[model samples]
Target: MPRVPRPAVVAAAALALGTLAIAPATGDGPAVTDPRVVTHFDLTRGQSPENIALAPDGSADLTLSNARQVVNVTRQGRTRLIATLPEVANPHTPVVGAAVVLGIARAQDGTLFVTYATGTAETGVWRIPARGGKPRQIAQLPPAGFPNGLALDERRGVLYAADSVLGTVWRVPRAGGAPTAWATGAALEPRNPRPAAKVGANGLRFHRGAVWVSNTNAGTLLRIPVREDGSAGAIGTRATGLYAIDDFGFVDRHRDTALAALTGGSEVELVRPDGTHRVVLTPGDGLSNATSVAVRGRTAYVTSAAYFTRRDPNLLLARVHQRDRD
Candidate 1:
């Protein structure tokens, strides 16, 4: 991963399907059809939406790379302009949420953790109130480091931020103290077979106890254990061999079924920890170009980004549910 001097725009324009994949089936379970879009929101265009979070009870939140406005779409599907331009600071003049919140992650208790930047030459990370209110600075980052993807280790009180350009993962203790780097491919190899030079450290989430992130460039998922000191523990592979994996979400208890947006390869991958994934949605097919993903129980939701950047709108939130599975 070269020094990402600026946020890159590798948006998905279209995705074609070869054919529907073979459905997975099991004893007493209905035949598993490839995942499909449950519902979609096409009104949001050019917002540059990237990361997503679903509350413990299934409420949803959206974040964009460039939008400064933290627009809140409630679980009932009602839209609220929670934080507007001057409100978030409009760090990015083009989009106000520059003071705007991009990633909204929630702990089991509904405490919201937000990742945002001032959109200036320098940026900082913030912890915002999920229900509603002003945001507080969690950590101020060094130059050239824009914290992108975020995941919270609720049980441990740690907030993991993927400093995409730094090609590193950093942590801020919710309890206090300072933020520290967890890992750098410079010392250890990225979990992906791709050389370290190609791995983009982005999109992170907690599954079980591991901190998992999408190595966007190498097309792999990397996991590390939680450390009391915010150090990147022994590195390991969670899923790989898939073309591209953007944002992540899990559904079943066995961790047998999880979801992600495959932007490069163009599709929504219904994946297993083993790395083999069944295509649940495609853009050129019946689906749209999905850039990020989230899942809650019976459904999976995907987001397409900035219309000009993608054939899909900036915000296309679609749901994928288990209609049948054996």
Candidate 2:
């Protein structure tokens, strides 16, 4: 999602990088036990972790949206450079208005796939070798469209990318070729006329037998069933009232519940299938502005871009308690 400037906050997110700290839960929600910042990124260098892809070896690959870089972080909080995208020739572009890397996904072989929403011909999905090298653009999307979220279905060798501005889900082959519009509807269109809040379909994922998408402006989560032929079936709303949700990951293998990042609200919520939800982390828990959530078993990894707070952009780790139920 594009960085939409916001008002400042009072207290900034605390806890030194690589140190452990616990923050009491705000509101009436349950306490998030043992939440700590794994890494404190340099805001001046635009090292904001926008999206996360978990590696098989337990490392997290992140897309530094504004910096146009992909980085890898080990479980011990060690960060390493993966690859950086091309520099933007012009600052002013249509749609999102600026060049930024939004979403990322990793293949089974360690290859990394990312989306670069540049308002130029260079805008598209790029592939980076696992060992690291010059990144290659595999799919080309419309320059006017902001491709914010990406998901790779390895079984089908297809990548699903959500274009926030175009309100379309594009299907691209992993091998590289032309892209096709997989799904499009008003449910994925931006209704908010505000310059900063005009994003739609901000996060995407492939789970079970369907593709799940988050409509940022509409505050809804949609599920599009994948037919036997690998085509999209009728679209359905799985949840609503998820204001400012950017990215999320299923907490359980059944896919009945999820840990969603509420970016503008600066919190992570435990959302259920019936649309009921509860805050699990907040600004008090070292979250400047939660951007994306990646869940691995009982451990949850969350990224805070600090786009609004403009303070400590960091990565947080928390344990997802399974005993609590709605």
Candidate 3:
């Protein structure tokens, strides 16, 4: 059974906070933060919106199923299909892209970079023009070098790929150069850790002088200490209680920390930046199997990945009012 979280003990995720705080709850809506943003991308169950990318221009892009492609979300979350990614598709095998979108980064020049997990014969990394264009494979990951995740240091032009199956993190030069091991299994595990290193690396995010990678097998996230010369090692685990984790995002700038959630949560549980976590929000609070979340500034839009059947659930977006709570 999925664990339930008490309303009083939110820990880090308690407040929607500051100018971005979520509104108080009311009977008119569900019992979550106010004006909650649900999936506006209009995707079917098979589309499997694995990874999403929001550019500085406010245009949003997300990866869909197959050795496939990403499409844009527009019309105020209206579900309309506009374009198909020809470059990322192979009609022979359709399920290739449904695995996981581990890394998402956009360059200063506005070129969007995406990294994939699981596998495919074509390539693991691709770049798309921000002005809207088909993605092209800039680098084809090695045969055995299964890159489960990816992130970039846009200022330095460094690309980091998490090698989940092989237990390593490799860096590839964004300008097109050889790939090198940025971190390995030996450097990722914590001494006398609550759990040992089984799968060394997953999920990559570049923030606060570190490359944060999620450990899927361990339900934890790790931050690797990095040097400008492309040298990196396991700094330490940043968060824990991450279930079947995939990707992570920062709440806002000027903060070294991030906001993350379980890509496949059975119910609500609170996970923290330092890897200490417990149940904070659960079924009783009116959330179910929340797989992904994105913040448009302070308002966070989450997804309920329960679209396995043919029917749409038409779930309502809920909010919490601060005044009502007090």
Best by TM-score: 2
Candidate-wise lDDT, in order: 0.55, 0.80, 0.48
User: Best lDDT goes to which candidate?
Assistant: 2
Rank by lDDT (best first)? 2, 1, 3
Every model's TM-score: 0.73, 0.90, 0.68
lDDT (tens digit, per residue) of candidate 1 on 1-326 = 11111222222111112212324422231112344333344434335556677766554666645445455555555655445322443344221223434455776665566666555533556665657676566676654455667887777777887765567787778754477877767422223322222335667777776777776655667778766664667878666644545666776544545676766555667666555566656665434445577766555556665323344443344444454352
Better of 1 and 2 by lDDT: 2
Q: How many residue pairs clash in each candidate?
A: 15, 0, 16
87-175 in candidate 3: lDDT tens per residue?
A: 43431211222334435566767676776543455546667776657766677665444465567787778888877556677778887
Give the local distance difference test score of model 3.
0.48
Please give, for residues 1-326, the per-residue lDDT of candidate 2 as tens digits: 54554411211111111112222322232234679998989978988889999998888999998889999998789999999998978845444466899899999999999999888888889999986788999989998888888999999999999988788999999998899999999988876655445677879989887889988767778899899998889989877767677898888666557788888678888777676677778999999878898888778899999887688998899887665443
Work out candidate 2's RMSD over C-alphas: 6.3
| Candidate 1 positional error at 81, Å | 2.0
